[model samples]
Target chain A: MTDARILTEALRDPATVAQLDAAGWTALLAIARAEQLIGTLAHRLAGLPMPSAAARVLEDARASAEQGRIAALWEAEMARRALAPTGMPVILLKGTAYAAAGLAAGTGRAIGDLDILVPRARLEEAEAVLLQAGWEWVKPDPYDDLYYRRWMHELPPLIHRERDRMIDVHHTILPLTARVTPDADALIADSVVLENGLRILAPHDMLCHAAAHLFADGDLAGGLRNLWDIHCLAGEHGIAGVEARAVHHGLEAAVGRALRLADRLYGGGLRYGQGRDRDMLYLRRLLARDDWGRPTRKLTRLGFYVRSHWLRMPPALLAQHLFTKWRKTAAQ
Target chain B: MRHATTLRIGPVGFRVGSDWRAPIAALNDLYRDYPQPDDGIPDFNVHLFAARPWRRVLRPSVHIGGDFVIPDAAPLPLVQGLLAAEMGMNLQMALGQRRYLLLHASAVERDGRALLMTGMSGAGKSTLAALLMAAGWRLMGDEFALLDPVTGLIHGFPRLISLKNEAIGVIERALPRARFGPRLEGTPKGTIRHLVPDARAISVMAEPAAPRLILFPSYGFAAAERAVLPSETFVRLTQASTNYVALAERGFGALTGLVRRVPARALDYPDTATVLEQVERMWSAG
Candidate 1:
């Protein structure tokens, strides 16, 4: 077994440790190092409440602090490029927010470069602007640029020609293939600008984005953290009317899934406990299984389906998946 | 007001009353609530609501009621000094999150390309920024320079170049015309205040400009000295940056791509005067 398994068992109790072989103990020490780092981050998060889910979500942040640093540099470069006698507005996303939110050194996720979303109308102009500022098109391979331009949801990624920092300029959150759309202009119109003159997505929109990310992709690799983000947003913003809109977007199942995750993984004294306890008994059966068990995969796939329930348009969609998977296989 | 000014970053919402209220309210009134409603506040903007107790909030866009407590035992000298440090950091976060493409370095633009002087704390970055600003290099923020993610152009947020005691005198003599606020006493950075450059007052917030050369400057006490390093040195310099590792996955490849496209060099200078001369030479050659 891998170190992850060994440590999980060893951390349980003295009896669990005693039951392990020497190999298991070796794995246990490695796990202990990871745990020590996580524990340190947790200690930092404890000082700040109200985000509700922040403390638990950051448990693994220390492991990913390096990623956060790269993201921040690119973010700074983007802002610098926009400076004017009257600077234009800009906004940051994800990992940048992790550190900016003052959880620095504790934000564990590694971000390659800053990811940004500007108005679609400004796309070409934005690219030109970056070029004018000494950022160059790094796509020596024309195919890569074409792939990003035609297939992906955002522009080809960019890097600072001199500083060597990277940036991803996006107009939307998910890929066009995912076929999810949120009103971009509407988000821009509703954005709140900071003293620095950059605008960021609002609370409702941020929550929707996180939930949509969870459901549209059905990739739960970051599931626990994403759910925690949603829960914290709700708790801090008050869930009062979020559930209805979430349901309208076909996100009720995702919300339920996220809540179930919080209940199962976080364990005891959770902030999202209100009105969600009723779903636990049903969800427990869904969650109980080994990693390789068919039950777990089936349950996970079901959650993915429920989250992507909005993709029910045109019954001919079944042909699309076959063609798409075939295309992916061919490309590889 | 508490509910209104609270914003979220990551999993937390920083509120104003106990943390960031005053500045948010002030900015809200100044900006007419956000023109775009869907794009709510980002988590990177910091607001100082109460002066005493020095209650301030950081990245208060999505959540509320969070506070940044600089430990009571920590070594802080000036009340505004803490604010400046917090603001310096948060300003970059705001720019980065908003796609301003801000960077952690000392910048001064000559011709179209910006000569970035970079290094971590005590590497003499802030001192260089202040010295250049005083020497009429036009300010682009002392702690960080904002770049446009798309164009790589840099902007200037020329407020003040924070300085300690000795550098204050060094800058004062370097440019006698430099304006300054009253010295802020009692802080960790050792009785600091802003050295306001004449350029900061009159410069038209300067639009984002291209960076022609990446110069990683190292200061020493040896006799006046200067050397130009290889372009590949930028990778090491870029790696030395605080946030480079954070953006590696999605943006790191791009950053590497950026360095490949630009000319980079390391400069070892004994003092600010030598730095300015080399900067002039690099841009002139460009």
Candidate 2:
């Protein structure tokens, strides 16, 4: 069947849009008229990364008379939430901050859930306030619940009862495993509150988190985005004491690993840190190799294989995680 | 197969597998060809892609794919098309963020706050998100809004808002400079593209704003006047949200808070211009 036919049949299930191929997408965009592209880009701003097509469209609409209205709503909501009785300290992480902060604007990486880190003591109270306002738990699986309660530092996903937006509230990050425990508490304690009343992790901790997350993934798939986030955060926030702090916390290795992946994938293109320049070059060389068909061999060798070992354990621990994961799955 | 192993949306693809290799390969291709960057592709994030035989389903898998580069394929005319669809809804799950839940919905922003436009198939949500964005609203996303459960903040991933028919022309007339990528005639959504979101919206691209409003928009071109519903009523109106069941408890709490904190409304407008004016007023209210 023709690519169009395949896509047509797929659209029969709107869910199919989630599975479009690359070439299919190019052809699809090529045919869209100027205006239609704008509308589509607006709707998908949260679903995918920003591309030139969508960016161009957005440029033309900036001066539209409607901008002030939307901006007003955003400001008011920020104020209202601050007034809530349970108006706990919240930090807007990742893209949420990036958009407001004006870093990496327009890249389409759909934000699935709004992530907030609240103190564990305030977890119940926060959940209660949200429920009263219209937030609902998205999952009820006991295993999943246990995983979040135990291994994870957050709760199961929550969605807006009416608006359908998903959210994840957290008190900490990462499991308490030996590999991740050292920096967890420090991250929470050192977080910085934004003008919006949300307390986000410090740049050092945030970059470390991104690093750990990328390593856990085993490939450079998220390497570029994560690298960019780190670069921007470091550049914007300044690595002033980041190197010393990262070392003190023993997370320097994690940061190094992430930087290596980024250099290999993006060639250390964006602006970043002075302290990290050496590490960045080392990482670049580590990842640099002959680019074959997909760079699969090089990518796999970069970090996935070694990192997989970090999450591994002896039979007993292995059983524990598996059993824990299985039970969580069962509960869900 | 009980269901297709992969799901395609526009030019994105999502797959779930325990074996690792196949899903990894599939995801690599998906990410390689996707028109923009993302956190869900193979290289985007680490997911527990497993093939355990848990008869009792837990942790769901969500896949979104559109045109990833496909070489040697015969030329065909189309906008954006979905080649397949696969999702393991209501499964036990977690992502790298370790702090938020991901939902399937199109998030559009206005001002500094986000207004989630959610609905099922043919609800005109993608079209609506596109239209509003063209009218000067920020595009948080076309599908999936990553929300922080504690703060109810919305993250913006500005990319093309894929559209089908009627909505296409609707956006065209609203913003003359908008550019489309391509068009495929046979797809259900008619032609699709890496749609151009409003320039201003893109400018403020990755901001996370507190969600102020939840509007369930059902297209009725015949309506002569704009209708605003109470936030409470709008709460009940969104029962059609796909992830409501899975995320019901948390979703309910967040939605209720948003309505009480902000204002929830159901918007019914005949054209893009009217919708823009009505939404603008709602956004302006404190």
Candidate 3:
């Protein structure tokens, strides 16, 4: 078997890690790092015996993930304080939400930017308040700013000047030009409120958002982390009405593909039917990492990059966007 | 990766891989005295690769990549591939190291105790540490000082001493027989050279020392010394640390205990001789 399969097999059954040798553990660590799932893997294999080197790396991963969790939660609280006067319920999304709700998906999760979903009507207000709270626009270019304002789901990524942490104020889950249009209002309406007056998407909606994020938005870079999220979410809150909720968001196919891939990779006892050939391609793209953590299969990566843009925008706009980006690079 | 090597520097082990042979060859030569990691497994992997396919052979530029990377770091010319590999290893420690409280300071040991010198870049800490090592103190590290939180002791990470611009000449004059890497000119940090630590530093690299004195040194100034209070020292050390916040409470406790246990002073001097005298005076006084 190929070295890449070692990561998949280990993730499917953490007990198999005990049987791994020094080389096996090295490959597993590298692949987990490449996939940005080292923290998740560390959590999965917390008690199992492994080599001392692997144990040290995993211990570091666990600590780093805890740091991420603390930072993510603190960012959410700061956003809440900033938006309190605006009277809009602050709805956290993705990693921040998982952390605030203390879900299993959040355990040992590595979070980057703080992703929050605000009402579309209150987006301008949210932007103003965040600015008042010392958040500045990261993309200063007028053209990129205009593009984000017109076509993106989030604000042009505001970063706290003093803290150096970024907060993405997303009005919806998907981009405005994407083919799949999730109901932003229903997402806010169905959000479950926390004890601290913060809100997170309900279980089914959270799963649907994770699926759409994996299959519809990105080019499957860091897809394993998203799949692990789905696996954990499904294990904690079963995928009972996730299909119907995904259909409501025009993301049923993406949700189905995500679940099947997650099950295939993590072996959660969800008996989904056989995935399509295209689903296999997605899996291949996700697993196209070599034992040394270098990316393999350039053709597959490029194909998915183009496909992600295609899913996000129409051909004409996509061409214009690509041209603008190419020009920017050339100028640089 | 066409060529690769593993090196254990103090507590951290690194597996360095390069697309070209020159960097790995240089590393093998420079680190020939160092030991390999236990079981041949590395804590971090450093990859020196070409940004593009043709770039590997055409005016080759080496991009630093590894488990953790700074995405916007500009590539260095292939001639500076050794510098790139060193930066890659440092980058991993700065971003991924959670085992210790990493201080952006230079350190040396004397009589089983450690003396830490920290300041902004171009502050002469590296030169001071190198000169002290030449003057009979054991070199602990030049780039980072690893503070073990549990034991409240500093671990020796005596990697190659990175001497920049003017300090190169000063060190070359002090230790004429010392081994040095090839002079890399016109690099980002300006004419750089790496000095191999003496045999004693490498032989006792595993030993941890109690920090007895902390100095904030600045060069190109009139000779002056001021005692830094514990509160101010705490804040300054936090700014001097890369992983202070990542280690969270353990880091806070370690740093707090260090400042309370050890006295600190800020020293400003006009030249190396004056700084050396001031350091000795402060050491005896402490």
Instruction: Say which candidate scores most in TM-score.
Output: 3
Please tell me which predicted candidate would have the highest DockQ against the true structure. 3
Residue A44 in model 3: lDDT: 87
- Candidate 2 has a DockQ of 0.03
**Model 2 Cα lDDT, one tens digit per residue, B1-286:** 1222333223222333322233344333433323333322321111222223341134422233211222232222111212211112112111211223354567776557788766566767777787776656677777666565568777664445666767677767766777654444665345554465555655556568887776656666554333355554444534533334334455566555555665556666676656667667776763
Q: RMSD in angstroms, all models?
A: 22.1, 16.9, 2.0
Off by over 4 Å in 3: A1-4, A328-332, B270-274
Error of 2 at A177 (Å): 2.8
Q: What is the TM-score of chain A in candidate 1?
A: 0.61
In model 1, what is the error at residue A171, expressed in angstroms? 1.5
Task: Estimate, for each residue in A1-332, the C-alpha lDDT of model 3 and write its tens digit.
Answer: 34366777877788998787766777788788877788888998998987777888899899888988987898899999999899897889999999989999898888999999999999999999999999999999999999999999999999999899999999999999999899989999999999988899989899999999999999998888898899989999998888888889999998888899989888886635567888778888988887678888899999999899999999999999999999999999
Q: Which of the predicted structures, 2 or 3, would earn the higher lDDT when compared with the native? A: 3
Ranking by lDDT: 3, 1, 2
User: Residue A157's C-alpha lDDT in candidate 2?
Assistant: 77
Top candidate when judged by lDDT against the true structure: 3
Single out the weakest 10-residue window by summed lDDT for candidate 1 chain A.
Answer: A286-295
Second chain alone, TM-score for each candidate = 0.65, 0.59, 0.98
Off by over 4 Å in 1: A1-74, A83-88, A103-110, A136-144, A244-256, A267-332, B1-286
